[model samples]
Target: MTDWARFLPLSNRDRADDGGVSRDRSPAVASLLSAIAAVLDARPDLLAAPTLRPEVTVDAAVRELLSELGAPWWRRWARGVGALESPRPEVAAFADDALASALHARAAALAGPERRASIHDLRATVVLALELNAAHGAAIVVDPLLCGAVALDLALRSRLPERAVVTARSLVATDGEWRVGRGPELPAPGGAIVLFLAGRADVPPEDSAH
Candidate 1:
C-alpha cells in the first residue's frame, strides 16, 4: 500500500454523499494530494490552520515540494504562486515582457532555427519566470518590446483556472517604456520592469484578476 491508497477510502466516503464521486476521486488525484499532505506534515510550521490559511499553507507546501523534488533555484522560487491567485495589473503587464524574455531564452537554447517552438514549453518557461519574480520580490526586464503580447497570452492561458488567476493589460511601448495603469512611469526601454502582482505584500487592491 501506497500512502495514497490508504486515503482512498476516506476520499471515497467524502464523495459518496454527492452521487458517489466522479473523476475527482480518481487514484491519481488522491495520490498527489496525499503526497502533498505528507510533505506538509514534515513541516509543521507550514501545516498551520490549512483550512483557515490555505494560501499560506499552499505556498509553504509548494516550496517544500520544490525543494524535495530538487528543482532548480529558479523553479523553486516560482512555486510561490497559488492557483486562482491573480497577478497585480501592473505585474501582469511587466510579466508580458518577462515572459517574452523567457521565451527568447528557450528559443536561443535550440540547436537550430528550424526547431519548432511549442506553446506549452514557452508557457512553462514564462510560468517559472513569473513565480521566480514573485518569490524574489524582483522584476524582469527584457530588451525593447520583445513579443510581449504573445508571451503574455500564452502564460495567462497556460495557468490552471482552479489554481491561479493571472491576467494583464495590453502592453504599449512609448518612448521605450511599457506602460500600465497610472501606478508609476515604466522604466526606460533598456531598463528592467518590476512586476508587483496581486499576492505580493507591497501592492494594494486585493481583487482576483480573473
Candidate 2:
C-alpha cells in the first residue's frame, strides 16, 4: 500500500526541495499523469465532448496548459488558450503530440507549493482527465479512497462562498475517512462528493445523500 499519510495536512505538504514536488510525492504525481495519458491514448474520443464546463472542454484545457506553463505573462494573456467559442473534437494525433510537447517544454513539477504553474495546471488536469474518464464509464486505476480523501482535504481548505440561503452541511463519507462543512449530515461516497462538487450532473443518486 502507498503510504498515503505522506500527503497529510494536504495544505502545507508537497514542499519539494527542488520547487517542483517533494521526493515522496513525485512518484504519485507522475503515476497520476501517466494514468491520464494512458486513458486519453486508448480512448481519444473522450476528448470529443465538452466537460461540464461548456467553454472549457478537455481539449481546450489541455491547450491552455500547453500555452501558459512557463510562458511570459503577456504570452499567456495573448493566447487565452482556454474557452473556445465552439469547441470541437481534436484529432488523436493532436492530443498525443500536444502532451509530448508539453512534457518537453513545460517546466512544471509534480505536486505544488501553491505557485508552480505546471503543478497547478497538471494537478487540476489530472483530476479532470480521471473524472472525465469515469464519467464516460471507464475503469480507473487510481483508488477511490485516495481521490476522495485528497478532494475533501482540498475542499476544506478552500474559501467558502457567500450569500448561500442554506448553511453548508457536514459531509460524512460512507466509504472513506473524510468529512467537511457543518450543517446536516450529507452522507456520500468520497469520489461521489468530489464529482458533485465539480458540477458533474451525472453523479448517480446512490452516490448522493440517503
- CA lDDT of 151 in candidate 1? 32
Q: Please give, for residues 1-210, the per-residue lDDT of candidate 2 as tens digits.
A: 423243332333344622642424344545555565566667666666676566666666565444444455454445445543212233233544466344333323544455333333433544565566555654556454445544544453343341120135654557654554456666766666555544553322444544
TM-score of each candidate? 0.26, 0.56
Query: Each candidate: RMSD to true structure?
Result: 20.7, 8.4
Best by TM-score: 2
The model with the greatest lDDT is: 2
lDDT to native, each model = 0.31, 0.48
Model 1 lDDT per residue over 1-210, tens place: 213222121222344453732322122222332333343344434333232123543343233322323134354345445522233232234322243243233334343434433333332333333333344322433223222322333323333431132223322233332332222333222111212221222222332331
Give the Cα error of residue 13 in candidate 2, in Å.
Answer: 17
- Backbone clashes (count) for model 1: 8
Instruction: Give the count of colliding residue pairs in each prediction.
Output: 8, 1
